[model samples]
Target: MRIGYFLSSEEYTPAELIEQAKGAERAGFSALWISDHYHPWVDAQGQSAFVWSIIGALSQATTLPITTAVTCPTVRIHPAVIAQAAATSAVLTGGTFRLGVGTGEALNEHIFGDAWPEAEIRLDMLEEAIHIMRELWKGGVVSHHGKHYTVENARVYTLPEQPIEVLISGFGPKAVDLAARIGEGFVSVAPDAEMVQRFRSGGGNSRTCQGGFKAAFATSEEEGARIAYEKWPNAGVPGELSQVLPSPKHFEQASQLVTQDMVKKAFVCGNDPEAHLAMIDTYAKAGFDEIYVANSGPHYQGLFDMYAHSVLPKL
Candidate 1:
């Protein structure tokens, strides 16, 4: 499988993200996955740079393809605006940019005080938003008056030679079906073979399926686990909490029940290249076309170096 690096916007500054992009390129990573978040999961994680600004800077920093691990174009921003931003991004990246989108989480989208829609309603909005974006990308004036959104004679002026590909992120059966029906590709953070098969059977056959996992690279496993827990305790918050929680404080409150061991189990904690490879292999065996690994601690350079020498060379 193609190995890529995931840039966590929630944890790193724009400069750090750009630096990581260059490092990933130099380290021989094939592509990039950058998260689009308005807030850090918790106070400890800290930074949340505007993803578009980082993407623009990344265009100048590296030649590797970049995808928004998932951008929500439904609530915080209008689809028309996202279309323009994504179009400019695709042009800036020399057409190597893909727009990865999903229904988004309340933690990011509830900032406007809008009532958080249920999963089904959010999915409906996402489908309409995608339609609007695709229409705008066709390079003509588009006026859409749909159930969830309205566009009045708006058009995306600066577009790439080809329309940007939309990769949908899905973690459940309904979302996966929507992705198969509309997305050019699929995106996920899990190595679930069942979901991959469901997407293919539902109509995503032959489409690219990309997956990602988090790692905490340090001198040893225990140290890595400590860093992961300190920065990403929310990783252990089970069920729909991730989707429904409205703020970092809310997540922190819910994360109180999460133990360091729970967080460690979710990430490949340590400097062991073999462990990293095993995690990557899980995604590969589950039929992913590409897999991305994201580092949770300050030792991202260490992680990159390990991948460049011990991990990537073997792959």
Candidate 2:
């Protein structure tokens, strides 16, 4: 499986993130998966930079193939606008960019003052948005009128030589089916063997399948767990809360219920190379073509060095 670094736009400055991208490439990671968020899940996790700007910088800073871990094109931004941004990114990256899209969360979409729709409606919207974006990416004047979106005489003038591959992110069976129907690739947070089989069964046999997990590398296990709990306790927030929580403050409140123990259990914390490799193996065994690890703490250089020397070689 190809190993990649997950750039958390919610936690680091744009410059620092670009530096991390450079570091990741130097360490031999084959690709990058970046979070696209309008707000950090909780205030303690810090800044949320514009993901498109960071992608532009990363394209210049590193040769690694980049994929938005998942961007929500159904809301906040129209599919036409996302299509244009993604087309530009693909051009900037010399066709090494993949657009991973999903049904959005209220945290980002609700900021536009629109009522958050149910998951089913959101899925429909996502389907329509993907169709519209694909139409726009064809490089001519295109007009679309669908249930969820409308595009009138829209065209993407600056597209890459290759058609941008659309990767769909999904958690449930229905969403997985949607990905197989429309996506050239698929992404999910966990390594579910059943989900991979489902995607393949739905006609995604030859598509890229990606999964991501979190890790916190530190001098000691205690320090790593502490940082993970403080900065990413929100990771432990159960189920639909993450999708519905509208503000950082709301997430902070929800995160208070997430304990350090839970955080430690969710992430592979500490400097044990074997432990990190074991965590990555879960995805590999589950049939993921690629796995991206997000470092949750400050010791990224150490993390990269460890991965390059030990974990990566083993994989």
Candidate 3:
């Protein structure tokens, strides 16, 4: 039941993110989760700093253990390159970093004009990418010609004292099985007991299971919901749309139908400490090893104070 702060890279500047990292540590969070995004989910979110650069800054900014909420290693960037970057990040954080990875979305991967493959194909790519990364992390030159990727004479010269742990993020059964087979841990946004059971049944019982949620802790519920709706209505866009949407503009257009009421239902808006606690309890009860929460608006300090004074202590 460890509680952590989630840094939303899409909404904050790099400097502000570093400050938030430090602030989170100071406010009694046990760890950190940072989203890795090349583009914002919607244009309203307004920012997307390079995640690796932020990781480098975070390694120096806070002692709190950090995880990239998830990074996609299969497309836009080659697996070998991501392996090198992740290895360097592990070293930079003194082994406090865990690499959380996934199959990725069109929003980020489509930038290089690569055709977004079907979900099944993407999973295959992710598995191969993981294998390539693990080999490079073992500290030797490696070469591979796989179905979806080719790595030639790749080696990571600098790595952490400990081997970096890789966590797989997924929501469905097939993906969960893949995580159990290869991942050192698992990650998800929702607290699904069945998913956790599937992981354990597939031999991931001993691995870390992490989840994340959002909160908009403003002075009033209406104000919180309004901000959340304005900034994150895309979150309510259901189904595979999140994975396949090609641009923020498309997302914004789709999210036009998401009302403030939808945001209110999805997020724990307002300054109610009890509501915040209840949201966290859902994840804790689901047996997550770690849970992280991100603010949906500019009032992060208020959220921190609420957690520090009221919410975190109860958990």
TM values, all candidates: 0.99, 0.99, 0.98
Tell me the whole-model lDDT of each prediction, alpha carbons only: 0.95, 0.92, 0.91
Backbone atom clashes (below 3 Å) for every candidate: 0, 0, 0
Model 2 C-alpha lDDT per residue in residues 1-315, reported as the tens digit of each score: 799999999999998899899999989899999999999888888889999999998888999999998899988999999999999999999999999999978988898699999999999999999889888889999988789888898899999999999999999999999999989988999889999999999989979999999989999898999999989988899998988889999988888898999989989899999888888888989989999999987899999999889888887
> Which model scores highest in lDDT?
1
What are the root-mean-square deviations of the candidates from the true structure over C-alphas?
A: 0.6, 0.8, 0.8
Runs of candidate 3 exceeding 4 Å displacement: none
Cα deviation of 212 in candidate 2 (Å)?
A: 0.6
| Residues 1-315 of candidate 1: C-alpha lDDT, one tens digit per residue | 789999999999888999899999999899999999999999998999999999999999999999999999999999999999999999999999999999999999999899999999999999999999999999999998899999998988999998799999999999999999999999999999999999999999999999999999999999999999999999999999999999999999999999999999999998999999999999999999999999998999999999999999998
| Candidate 1 lDDT score at position 25 | 92
Q: Count backbone overlaps in model 1.
A: 0
Score residue 72 of candidate 1 by CA lDDT.
99
Q: What C-alpha lDDT, on a 0 to 100 scale, does residue 306 get in candidate 2?
A: 97
Model 3 agreement with the true structure over 1-315: per-residue lDDT tens digits: 789999999999999899889889888999999998999999889999999999999998899989988999999889899999998988888898999999999999999888999999999999999999999999999999999998888888998889889999998888999999899998999989889989988989789999999888799999999999989999789889999999999999889888789877888899999988888889878878899999988899998888899988887
